[model samples]
Each structure stands twice: as C-alpha cells, then as structure tokens.
Target: MSENDETNLPVDAFEPNRERVKIDAGAFVQQGNTVYRIAQVLDFESIIGIAVETGRSTPLAVAELRPVATDKEPAAAPDLTEIADPDWREAERRFAAIQPLLGRYMVGRIEVAGRAKEIGVDTATLYRWLQRYRATESVVALIPKKRGWRTGQGRIPTFAEGVIDEVIRDFYLTAQRPSAQKAVIEVLRRCQQHGIDAPSPSTIRARLKAIPERERLRGRGYKEKAKNKFLPAAGNFPNADYPLAVVQIDHTPADIILVDDIHRKPIGRPWITLAIDVYSRMVVGYYLSFDAPSETSVAMCVAQAILPKEEWLLLHKVEAQWPVWGIPRMIHVDNGSDFRSDNFKQSCLAYGINLEFRPVKQPRYGGHIERALGSLLKEIHDLPGTTFSSIKDKEGYDPEKHATMTKTEFEEWLVALICKVYHERRHSTIGMSPLRKWEIGIFGNGEVQGVGLPQRPVDRLTVLLDFLPSFRRTIQTFGVTIEGMTYYAEALRPWINAEDKEAPGKKREFVFRRDPRDISAVWFRDPSLNQYFKIPFANQSLPAMSVWEYDQAKEKLRREGAKALNDVQILQAVTELRGKVEEATERTKKARRQAQRRREHEKNISPAAPILPVRSTPPTPSIASLGLLDIDTEDFGDIA
Candidate 1:
C-alpha cells in the first residue's frame, strides 16, 4: 500500500513492531515495541535492523521518546565492586513480589521496564530472577513441572502455592473497593508489621484490573468506556510553583458506575468534577454528578481545593475530622454555570480569593484537571475490562448488560468518588500520591502561601466598574429622581444619558460601580439630581437593554395607534355633541382586544401593523372630535 493508503488504514488494523534507528537530536519515531532515533528517513533502513510497523508514529509511544544525547551512556563493565548478597536478595524479593501483578496485554512494557531501571535494577535482571526462581522451585518440589503459558489462562501459577491466591484476593479487594490513602497506607503498614509483602501503585493498578469486569463492578458483564485527550501532558518538576494560586477543574462522567448500593454496574455516563493544584497536579477537589452540576458543588470544590492534603482525605473517612479554613487565594475554573454562579463569586469574595474563569467551551484550558480525570477514569474503569458477557448463541444481546448504567446516576457517583477514590488516594500525576502530596509540601501549602490581588477601589465607579461589568439599566424615567438610591456621579451622567438625542445613540452607556460589601447596589446619576447617588438593582434595570432589539420593533405602528385612537375619540365626541351617545367605552374595549390579537399574528411574518379588525364598516369615531393633546409631558416633574 502507498504511504497515504497505510495512513488511511483503520486503527485496529495497526500492529506494534519494534525498530531502532540512528537519528540526530530532536528527530524521533517509534513502532510497536521499539522507538527509533533518526535524524531522517535514511536512518530507518540504514541503521536499525528492526522493522517499522507503520509509516506513521503511534502517538502514545512517540510521546515518550526524546532525541537529545542519543549516544548511549556506555554500558557498565561486570560489577567488580561486590555488594552484600542480602542487598541483592532484597531487590530480588521486591521483584518477585510484583511479577504476577503485571498484565500481558498492556502496551508499555518498555516504559514499565524503564521505571524498574530507575528503582536500581535494570529490566534484564528482573527477567533473570523470574526465570531463576522458577527453575529452583521445580528442583525443590521433586516433580516434573509443566510449562506455564505466557498468557494467564489455565494456571501453572504458584511457586508459593497459597501466597498467590491469598495475595490475589487481598489485591482484588483493594481494586474492587479502593481505600483512601490513609486507609491504604494503614493497610500497607499493617502488612509490613505482619511480614506480608505490600504492593506499589503500579502493582495495585494491574492486579485490581485482573478481577473480571463483571466482578470488578460487583456485577455480571461490564465493558469499560474510553476517553480522548486533546493535548499531551506537560513534563513534571519537583519544586515548580506557589500554593493556592492556580487550580484546574474539568468534567468526566462515570461509567460501569454503581447502579445502587448493593448492585453496581456500568450503566451510563456522569459528569466528574475535579480541581487540581497546577504546581503539583494533586487533585484538590472533586465531585461526580448525575445532574447538571450546581453552584453548591462549585462551593464544595472551592473548599476542598483550598484545604491541606491529609485533611482533604479526612473528608472521606467515616469518622471525619478536618479543618475548615485554607481557602485558595485564587481558583481556576471553567465558565460553566456552577462556577459562574453569584454564590460562588460571593464565596471567593468572602475568602478574599480571586475566581478566574477559563475560556468558553475549552476543556484544555484546565489541562491538569483535564488530564488527571482521564487517568483516573482509565485506571478505575476502562483499561482492564474488554467484554463482560460473550456467550455465542445470544442474539444481539450483550452479556455486559448488568454493567450498563444511566447517565444520571453515573454523574452522581462520578461526583462522590472524585474525593473518596481519586483525590484522597495517590495521584499518579504528582507522584507523591495524594496523601504524600500534602505532607511533602508539593502544594507548598504552609511554606509557600498564596497572595491576593491588590484592589484599587474607585469612588465614581463608572470608570472602574465598567471594567468588571457590574450591572446596566435603561433610562426609564428621565430627569433626576431617587428614593434614597445611589446614582452614578454627576460628572459622567450626561455623556451616558440616553436622552441626548442630538448626539449619537451608540455612545450612550450605563456602568454600575459594584462594591463587594454591597453588591446589590450600583452607582448611576439621576441627571436631574446634580448630586451623585447610588441605585440598587431593584430600582434600576438598564444593563439588558439593547438598541438593536427596540430598533427591530415596529415604531411606525406606535404612531399610527395614537392617530387611530384620536380618530375614534373624535367620532365618539361628535355623537355625544348631537345627544346620540352610544356606549363608546365598550366599543373602544372591543377595538383594543382586536388590535392586540392582530398585532400578535403579524409579529413574526412582518413588522407591519395587522389589518385593522374594525375595518371601515360602521365607522365609530372621527379624527376631528377626539379632544387630544399632541405632546409627551408624562414626566413633567418640575415643568410648568
């Protein structure tokens, strides 16, 4: 196939193949198992013997390679320096303990091996140990042992016969119902006390995944859902930031989520909310929701985002004990309703922290929380489970029915476990885990405190308040008038007066100076009142008025209505002049009703006034006899 055709091939058709390439700094590529370092395509064929799986790169794998200093750090000579046998044995013991925890299907074995190398022993040593122990156990047992399948199907599994089942069961429980960090640590500590081997996060993740999907969700037949990422993760640093200044929030709906307390299944999707500290990527607050998350959730998230780590975990314990203070200096939030609420704003004000709203419709704006939720969702639900109930004869029926969920309930638990499982547990992003992230000052919570933004209060507020969009109202009753209401200062009132007919209409504006102490009141001037005064929102409602809206209305009809009413009144007066007075009031009421319906019908099709329902039949009024004034003096407050 042509390179373009290969690129077009379906993703499932793609297979991984490892290849090595000699490439210069910054040029990198990877195929299934091996990543090629190539300065150009020439290096692909000339340098590494491994074949490329595809013309293009597998993004997840390619993301791991860096071309800098591709020259290998010289291989070590056989270690002439002797270490104690016990030291090697301890390393060997740790390796043996987690070997069964590894999954065969996972794509990143090389990455896992890299982590092992960082732990003091290389991947080759670990493999040698697995083989060495197997041979030794066979000799000791005095039996001809059968070979074990690489894939775990029928088992030749146990070297320590009882330990495998026992460890698997305990590991399964943790996977089935993950405990808070404190609880998990306590369990691990207890295991240490009793001389049982404890598992690391990697092992815990893998073993927990081994439980049958149906069993994992505490039900029969459950398949997991996958999510996509818009951006790659940023590299990490141990001491990168100040505390409480930046927090990230994102939404994820839960899946194979709990159906009820006793029966859990993957039924539907739910919105999971989380706030993480930008510096450490430790989840500060989280909630999964079955409903459109409300302001209450936002307030709760703010509270958690600000508190200390251990205390944040206490919130999950049955016997809860935690502090209430420690609110952040500023919180990074999306423009969704929950975060945009007036109540949330007040909370920020009360705590003297700034609430920074992210751009509309962009999830990546809060990348830390966005990425963290994806990791948690994958860990708890998607990675391990493939198909729940795969019986051959059933027609179109998924055996995974028991694992299905409703979106609403999924949202509910998506919110609940955000704190219980995701936040209070260890964080893969920060790496100290959630519990350690707190004690380690990764948040810099106590040592590096958040500083609030300085406020420059302006008295006339129109100039300054306009910057923040306080509130706006129309010029309802022109001229100076107030009922103990505060008005915009006299100086800027004229420039903003809607009654300035000689000047341009677009130039008119109203700005309210919102005081944090008295948010309900804004300052605007009653032009006639010369003195500056404050106006409460109840007394003024200008901000929503739009010239485009009123311009779109039929103004000509308004003038015609005045003329028609005058003409009707004239005829009624003329009839009364001749002492032939008809019940004019009833006729006028009938005309008014007809006019209203006619106006409504014509509204959408055209702005033209409706055909007069009165027609020309039985003319009831004349233009001459309707005694009417042609001036608008409705608000002649001081006019003579």
Candidate 2:
C-alpha cells in the first residue's frame, strides 16, 4: 500500500504478529514502560506502530507517549531541617496510622473504629481528616479546622456588606467616635436607601469587630487619634543600643532657695539646665543659673558635656572621676525658644550632632531628663533650704529662713554631689553605677573601642566663645557699634564702612559673638582668615561687667536723665545701684529676682578673662582665644 493510504487506515487494523512486519511507518509511541521512536508515520492522532524485540508490529495509543524531561526539573529535594511542633508531630503520627489503608476500600466499620480509637479520635472524624489529607496531601489537614463564620460568612447578606462597611466608616470612626449602636442605626438607614435588607444589631456588631483596629483607625480616625491610640511607643535612650547614641536636655527651677554672695539672704529659685545621657542615665552636664533657661545655658551645658571635665573636677576639688564627654549622635529637647536658637542649631550641625526637638506639649520624649531632674532635686530637698517639689510638700516650712547656702556654696555642693554621689551610686534603670556603665562602654568590652572626645578646640575660653550667642554689627569708620557701645579691633580697619554684598542697601555687617556673662569684650571673626579677634569698647575705661550689670547701670542713667553717658557715668550708676541693693534690710520680690538674674549672668562669664586691662586699641594675643551687646541690647534682646 502507498504511504498516504496506509496512514489513513483505521487504528483497529493494526495487530500483533509473531513474524517481522516492515512497519515502515514510524512515529513516537509508548508500549508499557518504554517510548519507541517509530521510523515511519502512521495514523498520527489515534495510534502508531513500532518494531519490538519479538520482531512483531505492535500498535499503541498516541496518548501514552510523552516527551523526555529536560534540565528544568530540580535535581535534589528541598531543605526540611526546621524543628516541628507537637501539633505537626501529631498530624504526622495520624497520617502514618492511615498509611496502610490508603487506596483501599474499608472492609468493615468495626475495623475502622478500632484503628481510629488507637489514635484517640472517633472513626467519623478520622475519615473526614483522612479525606482532607488525601485531597491536600498535607499533614496540616489532620488538624481540626476552626468553627464557623471566621470570614464574616452568613452574618450579613453578601450584597449588604459593602453598604454596611461604608456606613460604619462614616459614622463610627469619627473624632467624636460615635457608639456601636449609632453605627448600627446608620447602617440600617443606608441599607434602607439602597433597597437591601439590613443586618441585625448583633450581626452588625460582629461585622464591626471583624474589621482590624489598625484598618479602622487608618480609614476613619484622623492622624491625631491614630498617633495616640494605634501607634507603638517611641524608643527611649536607656534602652538605647549604644553609648552616646542619644542625650536629653531639659530645665527645671531648683527646689531650693539660694542666698546672695554677700548678704547670705534668700533669692528666688535658681534654674538648672540638666543634660543626661540616655543610655547610662549619666548626668553628662548641668548648669545652675538664676537666669531662666536660655540658649546660652544650653550651649554651656552641651559644651561642658562634650569636653573632658578633668580640669573642672580639679578646680572644684572633686575626688571622684567624671569621665562622660562626647558629642551625642542625637540630642532630644523640648520646643523651648532656647533650644530653637540659630546658633545652637548651626553649631550642632557643624559638629554632626542631630538636634531633635520634641513635639510641642509632648513631654514623654524627654522623660529621661525629666526623671533625672526629679532625682537630683530630691537630693537637693535633703539640703538646708528646700522648697520641696509642690505646695503640699512645702506646707508650713520656711525655705527662706533655712536658706544658708550662698549661690557659690550651692554650686560647689552640686559639683561634689554629682561626682562623689550621683555618678558613683547605682541607677535603677541601668542596674549599675553610671560611672561603671561608662567604663564598660569604653573599656570593659572585648572589642576595641574608646571614649569619644570633642573634635573642636578644648580651651575653656575657646569653647565658650565658639558657642556663645552672636549679633549683627556694621563696622563703621570709628568702630563697630553694638548695644549703644562702640567696639574696635585692628581686624576691622580693612573692612570699615563697606557694604555687604549679601544684604543690599545695608552697611557691611559682621557677626559679633559675646557671652552674656560679660559684655566688656566682644568677639569678631575675620571670616577670610577664619580667626577670632577680640574687640574692646571704644571708651577704654569700663570695667568687665555682666550684661545684667550693664543693664542695671544703664537703667540708672535713664532714670537720672543723663543725656550723654560715658564709661565713668555708667560705672557710677552701677556703684550706686550696688550700694542701694546692699542697704536694703529685706530685698523685695523684684529685687530678689534681679539679684538671681545678675548671679546667673555673672556665673556664665568665663574665668579665663575675668579682668581685661583698659585699652582703646584691641588686645592682640597669640593666635588663640576670643570670645554680645550694648546698653539697650540687654533691654530689647534676649540675653541668650
């Protein structure tokens, strides 16, 4: 027969033969286990012929043949080394119990029950589980399934779910947070409008409970609610992962009354600027001043915190070690005006310290520092003159009468307390002394690490000048005028009377940084050379006095109606005011507040240049140290 005619023959025509058949028509075919490549084509759809070992032609269906597997098939099994739980082991055990009965019809009910009882399960449950296991081939199927309505099934009509969800979102999660009953009423109202049957109150409650708390808050509640109720608690410093990672700064009025240096009489409370390391609960730095908390106080505290305190400890005759010093990676502070100063922000940025201002009205972010202040104040409460913490605590007690410690004495006592007691004593949060923790962080660990030190100049005067508050002044031909006082430096000679390119139509303005503690000599930076130059007052005869002193002196001049005042007149006013302050038997409340302010201002003046010689030309020193304002400068501007 022709090849085309043979190819059209019916599948049934082919039959096995003992003798050799030509079988010239070849195609891919499978007999029992092996696939044979037929040499010639036959009927392609139904059957193909192959030559076997018996030398007979055989016919097989085309459906039996399959192509060989390629590299796409995985060569090895997957990993299964993970530990299995008891439930999984039980499921595996149950599956093993049924292994023999697989693919076999049950012979008798009694036999099946006996087999299930062996595994502590009923026959009916076993069969159900076995059927599920067979379907999924997973041991997990042997575990009993959770009972009913897990996915909001049968509670509400399928068509009504969307309408009810929308109604609940609109009425339930508002700022007012209406009750579940109100949400149900709204849901029924919407369902009535949409021509759908409303779910029962119980059904509606179930559906509402079905929605996740997070999703409900996100969709319906506003950001404030979401943040307060749904968000996780923020991480604090004590639980910090590393040392110097975070620091917290805060201010509180000390709970004790301080006396003046000369009279030993009571003054108002001194404000304490406290900065504590979060990780170790160590008091990194603190500043005590009668002036209310200001940017200068913050700068003073932070600079002290970042520089080694060996010299300070020695000066105060403190025996214990106070090793804490480093520029913290981040500083957490409240939204006080002092913390928001441009000089504070810029200085922190220049040194790669992150200044984090806590949200307004949120005191939790600074809890560490707040608690430290509380602890320190508790220690102060044990001293001679403490107001205690609250009115209830201070009832019928005479803080003023008991007040014997002057400001200087109180400061000395504080230094001793911080070093000998607070640093050495065990802290509750860390369960160890802060000094011990500091040592462990630096040297106790096996790995190589060292304590961080300040990168900038460590000179007490230089550091003070670096962080002191600054002002804008134009260098006139005579000198640069600030706060009604004219200061001239040799460095100002070249740029006198020039206009600033950055600020149009304005005289050339240079930055003059000054310590509020002493306004006698202000600092001018030669921006080109990046060197600091100390500029002296043009008058040449004024003694070094705090901005507070200068203000009190100028106020006296204003009251005396002196039209043109010189250094001599200012000094006389200051001397007269001091005499009046000293003569008063009992200082008035206003007088006490002013004295406290004066004490704070004077305390901030660097001991480095306590007394500068009177000279008109600016004092020139080796490329080294230099460190705000005029008469009304203290009146109109913030001392910080």
Candidate 3:
C-alpha cells in the first residue's frame, strides 16, 4: 500500500470536500487526496471502502470520517430571518392546516378530506402541503409560491397595490375610524394621481379585511380592546394523544446540594432543565448546570432530548436504557424570556416544531411537567445532601453538613432513577409504567397502528448547531472576534473583509454559533455553501475555558484596576485565576465549585472512547416482576 493510502493522512488532503457529508454505503468519502467509495458497512463503528483512483481496499473508522456536501441532496433550509412577512404568514397558515396530519401513523383518505374541507383547500392541495412539510421538516417548505402570483393574489398593478396599502394605513387605520367607502375613495384618488388604473372598491375592502384582527384593532387606536380580546384564556392542557406529540420543558433549581469533586464540601444547588413527554409522562431529557436558566440551557436540554442518548450515557458510565429520542411535534413551555427569544423560536421553526406558550397565570396548563419535576425533586429529598423542599421539612436536617455526592455522581444517580425507577414503575394516571406507555404509543397495540420512531437526523452536529445561540459578526482580515477571543480557520479566507451585498458600503455580518460550555472553537456557517466550519482560536496556546470562567477572569482584572485588556492579557488572567482556584479548591466551597466546572468543560471537549452500540429498543420488562406494589404514585388528575 502507498503512503497516501494510510488513514493517518492530514486533513489538508480532503480540503476540497470539506463540507457536511452523510455516512452511508456507496457514499464517496474524501480524506486528504484519496477519494474512497464506501463499499460495505461491517458495523456501526467501521466501514470497508475502495479508493476511487487507486482501486485499493481500505477499512475506515466511522468516527474519523467527515461528511461532504452533494448537489443531489436538497438545498439547505432558507434563512427564516430573511423570509418576507407575507411569505412567513402564508407558511404558518399552511402549517396550521396540516399540523394534525404530522406525526401520525398513517393518514387515511377520510381524514385528509375532512382536514382539507376544514381548511377550505382541496384534498390534493392538502396532500401537497403535507408532502412538502414532511420532506424538509421545516416550516419554510410550506411558503407560498414566491416566483409568481398564486390563487387569490391581487392581479392589480404594483402602483395600485401601493396606493391601496397607503390608504389602508393612513385612512382606514386611524382614530377617526373612517368608513370602508372613505378608504376606497382615498385609494382611487391616489391611484389616479399616480396615473394608474384604480382597483375596484370590493378589492380595497378585501385588502382591509386581510389585516390581522389584533393589528387592525391596534392600528384603529383600540389598544385596550385588542388587549382585552387577545389575552389567552385559561383552559385544560391541549390533547397529546401520542408520544412526541407534545413535550413540555421547564427549569427548576435542584432540591439537593452538591459537593465539588475535589473537597466533597457542599456547593449551592444546581439548576435542572427538564423536558417531559406529555402523553407517557416519561422524562425525555435534562441538563444539570451551575449557571442560571438561559437560552443555552434550553438549547442543551432540547438537543439532548432529540439526539440518541447511548453515547451520552456511556460517557457518564451509566448503564441504563433511555430510549426516548426524536423531534417533538410541539414543545409546550411557559412564557419565559429564554423560551421567547428569537434564536430559540427560529431554531424550532426551522425544525418544524410548533412552539406553544402556556396561558398567563395558568398553573394547571403546565401541571404535567410540574408534577414530573416535583416527583424527581421528591426523590432527591432522600439523598444525603437534600435541602428537603421546605424549611419545616428541613428543621432538623443540616443539608450542607451532610452533603456527599459530587455533581457527576448526582447526574448518574438521577439517570438511574429516571430510567430504572420512575420510567419502570407504574404511574397513577396512566395506569401503567411510563416505559410501557411509550412502547405502546411508538410500536402500537393490537388495535392502533404505531407511528414508529422518528427519522434520525443524519448530521447530529448540525441539529445541535441549529439549536445553539448564534452571533453575527463581520469577518475581519485577522478573523472574527467574539467576546475578547479571536477565531480563525482557512475556511474563512474567502469571507475576509467581505462586503454586505444588501448594503454595498457596509461589512457583511456572518452567522456564527458557539457552545457556551467550550470557547475553544466556534462554528461558522458559510453563506454560499450553507455548511458549518469549525474555527479554532487564532492563538492556539490559550487553554480551553468556559464563557463563565472567561467573564470571571475579566471581572477580576477590572476589579484590579486594569483599564484595558487584549485577548492575550485576558487569557493570562484566566490562567492565573485557574491556578488560584486550584489552590483554594480544598478550602472554599466557591473555589471547589469553580474547579469542578473547569473539569466539566475539559471532560466535555475530550474525545469519547468508543463503546458498543446500545440497542435502540430493549426488551420490555414485565411490570408484575418489577415489584411496584410498595411504590406510591401521585394523582395529578387527567393531565392528558
């Protein structure tokens, strides 16, 4: 075999094909200069391939392979931020029409006909919308025809349309509350002045009626009426008939205190962000962190919920089957600032997930998730470091003095409880174990057909990138700078100092996604290719650090009267601060916690050692043999 045939070749050899690629038999994988055709998949971990040019046989590890973009695949999802308002509204309307059909086992002709009639569209048109939405799994796919006018579109001239809009905004939408006739008269006069044929009075009325009810009321100076009419009414939870039909996510501080890895002393409670499947009452995903609840926590928890958990479980050395994974049809959440952020909303829309906010002041609307979190916290109350929920409950117990478990240990214990205990034990409301409920919903019982598992995303990293918070920065000659750190890669060469096409004189702002856990690299999405490239720090000598640690270091320098700082000075400060944290780890609770956080970041970025692929659906255990007779269940009263 030639020296180039070795898999140890540098990444530079495959520079031309360095875009996102999928793993599959017959797919061409380019590593350095060698282009190999995947001949066969021996297992999930390895593949046998033949070099295209040399016709030489090669065995490749799946982990070492990188995906390359191909023209045969569908074009990347549209940038929702740039979508026109009218198009966005149309897409939402179409999505609403076909939402019931999504995630169904099968759509029968009768169901399609009924839905079509309800939405006032023909069955054929409804099917087309369903096909498009399912094919891309994106709301953008349902956008109305953009190139030409479709049915019900105005056939009037552009000038006439503009005149109509001006009249509606200026005349119709006013405190005077002018009549439709008056608005039509104003539109006619404007069209005549512009030397264009005026649209009929009926067309003008139709356009006025097209305005949203809330917007119309507000524009007509009926702000109070709009608010009164639009306030969400408290009601029972929406029906979630199947698994992943609806998942509720929320954040709560853990009831137990955690000790640091080094000193085993009590640190403050960590926040837990959890996602629960409403139908089965199964815990889908969770994130444990010292940081307060933010968009980052939501993103992390959602990503974990949607991705396979086998690898993550193995990473923590937890032996259990957590079979829940897939995109939910709808995510029900409270009206928190983090949940309502544009970044989070856009990410959900891109993935075809409907985001429904709970009505204000309605505790019962979120009862399912709240109860699930309560149960988990109740379990935590039994642990040695438990805060015991209330002051009365903890009157004699000293939680801080009794703190024993480290964060990692607590994570493992929580996973065990969720998988082995809660999921396996029978529930009061469902009258069966959550695992069994999920199984029957996904795989189906004798009467009802199951919808089966959701289509696993081909690019797991891209799925995560979509959920991560994004920043827009102009690429400088040296590269893009974010939060005092500079990142650069050869992939950014063509975009250096690029001018914005929309605004010729201004620099272009490119989209970059970063994981707050690790600031060593940021993922940049190329506008032309629509692929993410990992850009590492320009100065490679700087050690890996979390954004929190970075901020702490910067704050320390500010307190020390350092007026100005560069990337190098800030990193030096971080290094010195880390040393002090290590030195004080045994003496102070805060220092020990900080050291633990640093270790977590390091562990997160470290490469995971390979493990055997866990079975997706393990054998269903018998409920009778699980000894549920002594288990107590709480009744939340018909959550579904």
User: TM-score for model 1?
Assistant: 0.28
lDDT of 3 by residue, 1-640 (tens): 1233344331111111112233456766555445567787564356788876579988986545543322233444435555556666567667767877874657998999987766556688778788777655667677655467776543566567668778877889999999878888998888888789998776676566556677789989998998667543342245587889889999999999999876788777999999999889989888888878988889888988876676777767778777776789889999999999888987787677878898788687788899999999999998998998899999988999999999889988988898889999998988999998898876678975665545444334555567777888899989999987899999899999999777899998787777887888887777677555779999998888888988888898899898877777887899899899889887888888788878866665211111221111111122323232222111010000
Please give each candidate's TM-score: 0.28, 0.56, 0.73
User: Against the hidden true structure, what lDDT does model 2 obtain?
Assistant: 0.60
**RMSD, every candidate, angstroms:** 34.9, 32.8, 11.8
What C-alpha lDDT does candidate 1 achieve relative to the native structure?
A: 0.36
Deviation (Å) of 92 in candidate 2: 59
Off by over 4 Å in 2: 1-239, 444-457, 501-506, 553-575, 585-640
Which 10 successive residues of model 3 have the least lDDT summed? Answer: 631-640
Q: For residues 110-174, could you state the per-residue lDDT of candidate 2 as single tens digits?
A: 76677665544457765765665543233434432324344422334555767765776677876
lDDT values for all models: 0.36, 0.60, 0.72
- Best candidate, TM-score: 3
Look at candidate 2 and tell me the lDDT of residue 440.
66
Residue 639, candidate 3: alpha-carbon lDDT? 5
The best-first sequence of candidates by TM-score reads 3, 2, 1
